[model samples]
Target: MRILLAAAGLVLVYAGIVSLVSPGEPAASPQPWGFGTGVAVRPPEVSLSGGLYFKTYLWARGGGGVLYLRCYVYSRYEGGTWLPTPEEYPVLGVYSVTVGRGPFTEGGALNLTLPLMGGCVPVATPSVDGLQLGSIKVLAPGANLAASRIGLYVAYAGGRLGEVTSFYGPGDLPPSPEDLSLPPGQAGVLLALARNITAGCGDVSCKVERIKEFLKGFTYDGTMDAPWPHIPPGVDPLMWFLQNKRGVCVHFATAFVMLARASGVHARLVVGYMSDGPVPTQWSLTAFSPHAWAEYYQPGVGWIGVEATPPMGVTPPAAPLPRETPTPVATTPEAPPASPGPYQWPSIGLGVFLPLAGVAAAALVGGALFKKRVVIAVGEALRVGAPRGFWVYVNRRRVGRAPVEIVFDKPGLYLVAAGPFVRVVRVVDYRSMAGRAFEKLLKKLKLPPSATPREVAERFPQYREVALLVEKLRFGLRANKEDYRRLKEMI
Candidate 1:
């Protein structure tokens, strides 16, 4: 009976080992871009969940208190959405331009180079200044350039000494029809608010100032609970913000643009980083520096920057050294793939199969050793005959006379004695104990009963260590008392 029970346990252990070590099926290939045929790719919805966008390195001498690095410009506002110009729009391309070589030396020149971090083309300075442009590459007419670095020369009027400033030069393009576009659903609300805010304002500048002052009343909160909150179905996001009076920089900037457009002004939304303060040579800007502001088109004066968002009072921490080094201008040949050798398959098979075979062999050897120890103990207990009328006792409970056979249904430490002989033995069924613990863990985590170790690890990364230990124990791998104790603590 003991041998039969041991054989059954071994079979269960072997089955678990095979299941745990078997390779899984290959994953399906990813879906192709734009889905299938004839499907229109939707533009990614804008997220105001602000995060680090990119880093900018600036070398400047003197400029205005604030420096702007412009990235994406949106002119079309539909409902509450701001859309950028089509990719087919024409853009000015420049190969290279040198500064400080010519006689033009009045205001300080800013030498700026930032990597192409995203899809948007970044301009270092406002294009209205007529600054020297350099190393600006464009792919075809309207396609964005896939360049490593974009370099630009910005000339700004000298202001305070020791003040390092960078500027965003949005190309000098006249306002398009899209700039004056207003939200269809919220047009009436926006126009009414714009009129009420700029009631006594005479000129465009006065109206813009009035709108900026009006926006200061709204609370500035960088943390957004949802991308578009308080917006009911069919209601515009801008309308919701106007009613709620709370949002981040994007909300403030969008509101200002809509109000300006409704008041018969050509205004657009600019997304970029705003850096200011005194720097002897250079300072670093990080993801925390991303901001959005408004730009209104003024006749003869060109596009003027407007700050409608209240002060966020956030200062970007100085970066630890430069994150990336400038790549050298060079081209290299691609290397050919290596050919598989004749013995590759056999070597790979041996490499994977050997470890599994070793684990099985070790498990069998350990089980045999334990069985031998049990046999020796049983022999000793039977050989020592009890006195006349003497009986056997296990934990103070009498079973029978001397030379009796004892079998434990559960695994644990036990005390056996008969007549003048006494013995202590520990019986452990590692596989069963591990199975129960793993099942309990799955229940605690609310995972399905069919959840595998790999799935559990992937789903709850915090339980990765426990999952690995359980996998080993479930497969009858060698685990000491300490290992089981640790597993219990983890679960």
Candidate 2:
């Protein structure tokens, strides 16, 4: 009875600890388009929720560094939202030579396999001479949306993948009015800020440079709330970012376009993935790689790409202030929104786990001491009987006669019988205990119960060693008990 009570107490303690630390399951986002497959047609509208999508693969032989996979280009800015002009030309049977200027330096072909997460098909090529559509049916220069499974025969120059720049030709029409449109209500402040940043700029190129430099000074924080969900309802996201000066790629790119347009430089917001490091022969791109940037039109050279977002971990110089004070614009009286600090998953886990760990250690140690006392008491009681032909059985398996000592390789409750006496003994292994606790941690992270060790490692790269240990135990492989002890203390 005493042994059973001790085991039950330990179980209850673990249950309470789990209840305290585990978080409710996160709500899953709706995915209208199938994941990891190509789509036949573009969707009418798409929403951004900042959730991760399926992975896409790209295979390329040549060129590297910030491969600009051109997707959608938004020319119109209505407040905080961007809209593309309604103009698409058919380029189904046209050869690459007849497009903008001719083919750029022929580099190699790039094969892209995309999942059906969004409407636009991202196309990256080294050719800056023309908008190479390959066999794609429709081409929207203003919006650049296309069907999936896009293939481009890229042409290279200086080992950099060229963007879709040829469409904005020297003799082509000027930028649309929509490209220069500023957000309502905040137009005055935006124009004033733009003029202030570009005070010494002599031409459009100089103004573009000034705007890019100013935005680079702001911090790049991806943990903040999505742009659409600004605090104090109905506040423009761009205005909020300008006030805070810290945001993700979208915030930085949108601000750049707005500032450039206000300064009479025709610019558009481009959404795509930026392959930052060295490009391997085959690259696997995840949803985490989605990025946004700005492009401004230069008369003779066409639209040139400008990276405004500061590189990760590089502290840029302080943003320049206006040389002279401008007229004040009336604003709301609401308090400024707070900046969301760096990613906090690691800190949050530590904060919740530390206290519970202390309590768990106490409970486990108490259980172990009580278990040792019970075992000694049972041995004494069995030895005094001194009956002939005495026998002992564990879990219905007959082991030996009197004074039997049995060993268990795993942790669990087992039935032991000695002659007429029968009792339940619970075996405990610290390694197994830690493994169960790790599983509970996985559940708190919203991973599926059957998630594989590899999947868990992918989600939390920091816990990779723990995942490997768990994998060994699950698959009946040889696992180091000492390794578990060291890792537990480290964690």
Candidate 3:
């Protein structure tokens, strides 16, 4: 009876093993990574000293059967020019690459020339050193394979090595160890977690208390090491938060998501540009500026960006202009103060027996003598060279392109400048300098000081904008509200 029972037990165990080996159902869709689902190739960090390289190993099977590897390398020149990918920049050493095929078969190699280098149009010739493999391997029929997974490894040569991965493929695979570092419930609880982070609060009583203690001693200096550092390295953000304390923006963001996941939340990192564009003069004409922040998933609110970088080092404001030293005026035999005289007018009309209209007209003529008409010369074909998006301010008022003219309400010194970005400022002393010049020119031609910008534009429209821009820069002063309104109307 005992022998029969032992034999029966062995048979039962064998049947159970067979069931475990051969499941009757297909696997679920969107297989979870260590923490979530999907694949990402993160760019690796490199030192500024240069000579860096990147490599990746990949395996994939089932659907869309084609594979593509796109590579772009960027370089920066000393003068702030950026060269774009695949373009070969001049460098000190040569770089090389090799591909291995064993579990996978190797495709034939192809050599191609790269089109761009370091973001600039190639003014000089350069060469690329690499090989491209374009073949697929077929798995043997008798192997115990449910599917085939491919492996791809890469190595880089020369210059500084920096790399970012942008794509990964079709279906069911285990999550990378990076994925496993996510905080619990990270799939759904992103926003609540972010709010807790910003508030220095959390739902877990111990975590909340610890955070409260952490906030009691926060600093603005952005130290990456300490008892109060937000996140630490080596361990994942969540584990670090629970065990240690320290990190920068990268650390804070990573830890925020990790903590959220542990609390049944979902989150991801977001890379983007700052909302405020760079100061006009500081802007670059070539390439995009890059930044990194993070996002958390909330039920109704969706994903929200969370800035973890410390506030101590926000971008600085534009620098102020240097102060100018005043120069002393030289005195040379200055005239003595003059004595007041009785009002004397109408030498011809009043001295003689004149009519009332004549006396009134004489007074008007005298008043006209005190006021000088400012004639702004509008020119055709004016060229105002500047970088894109520079706002042009004229006479303290904004104006559209030249050949435009502005009459000084009361001319002392008028200042004209171009900005949002102020490259330079020009002062116009027409009443003294240009006025005398104009008078001399008019005297030469026997003309009057009644020239209008419109008249100038009609005669020389091509220089109209240019003339106006320069005139404002040289002669115009900052405009008050009334002047600005009038200026706007004139334009």
Candidate 4:
């Protein structure tokens, strides 16, 4: 036994050594989109142009499985750009990040990269500034969510903050609009250019192509320089971008949206992720994937992605042009208000097993911890006594409202809530009750021999829950009113 224990100790020591030497961040394999497989090192600039990927852990329906869903945002397209919606959608999440001043993407430093819990896509100012999502969670009735495989990306300047981004949630689908209207704007440097850019284009298709061609001259930059030394006070930034050819995806996308609008085509800036992976339904993103782009909406064609900034290392699959554009997936119109379908319980539909890839990454990245060895037997029924009403809570769900007994096949920490009272209980024989094993668990807790289990439980918070378990396993005693009374007194 001593030798076996020593061997186990040595194995633990080896594991600790390996963990210490490994990289702190999870690594990714070379992706089709251009993200390199490597351990990410923080970059010097927030606007370091280009893409990166991150890993994520996703759970659906409370760990039933992954809910295969496409998470993105939509807006009305007119004047060659996306129009902001009227309804303000509040992002629901626990934490928020701050930068120099506000939620602005270019807020700099602390505010540069923001972490998000995915329900819908966010609209960033410049088209290229996009998110490499770390976790994508879908919450529905009777399900759970989790994330894994976290990687870092160079998240930089895709501007525009506090704009309303909309999603098609649970509701009857709305009619697809064929066209949109342009907003009123002052005529300046942009008017003449817009006229010329769409001069010969009589149809929407031709006009859209011309705008894309005009913006092709622009370059992608992390910190895009102002197009010229001094801009006329009234000239729009998009006008300046046209005058100056150098900029990042954000610069190019912004230019496209404005220029398209100027040309009398319905247009809007669309924000979403740009990853090498064609379908994001199964994967997570990194900072490198946060991107902004332009979209010209066609009533029947929907919003098609316009590629203004050419990809640097990898080219992702492009949205087909208006004529050849494929219907975007998850156009699964929200279920109609009165349309009835067969009722069924929601099940886990992880489009793929993406989380399995992160197990090794998590082990290497997360530090080791002491694991308590336990032997539990299944099918062992513990007689639960409750004079008043009680509810047994295991893994966060209330199993039953108890006027009677609690039979558990799995052993772990449990809480029994009755009236305004609650007590923690532990059962030893739960998983596999094949053989009889007597344990001196109380002694391991280092309580004095004279210390009654009840007294130890009352005095020490840690032992309170395990007290019953120790007595049950060691002395073969069933929990009774005395155990209940003692626990109730301590609480």
Strongest candidate by TM-score? 2
lDDT of 2 by residue, 94-121 (tens): 1121233332433322332112123233
**What's each prediction's clash count?**
8, 0, 50, 55
| Candidates, ranked, lDDT | 1, 2, 4, 3
Error in Å for residue 418 of model 3: 21
The TM-scores, one per candidate, come to 0.43, 0.44, 0.23, 0.34
lDDT of 4 at 71: 23
List residue ranges in candidate 2 displaced over 4 A: 1-57, 89-101, 106-109, 115-117, 125-173, 223-232, 280-288, 313-491
After superposing candidate 4, which stretches have Cα over 4 Å from the reference?
1-84, 88-186, 223-236, 276-288, 313-491
TM-score of 4: 0.34
- Residue 475 miss distance in model 3 (angstroms): 39
Better candidate number, 2 or 4, judged by TM-score: 2
Residue-by-residue lDDT tens digits, candidate 4, 1-491: 64454445445534432332221322222122112222221111111122211212111111122111222333443332333332322212211211111222211111111122121223222222221112222211111111111211112111111112111111111222322333345345556778988897787777777877777656654422231234345554444556677655555766776676667666555444443333222222112234556656544444454667756512433322112102111111222111123333322223211121122233333432221222222223433345345543222234455554444322344433333333444544320121111113325555422233444556776765655543442222132334434443433
Assess candidate 2 and give its TM-score to the true structure: 0.44
lDDT of model 3 at position 211: 29
> What value does the lDDT take at residue 347 in candidate 4?
27
Q: Model 3, 37-101: lDDT tens per residue?
A: 11222112211112111111111111221122222211211111112212222121112221123
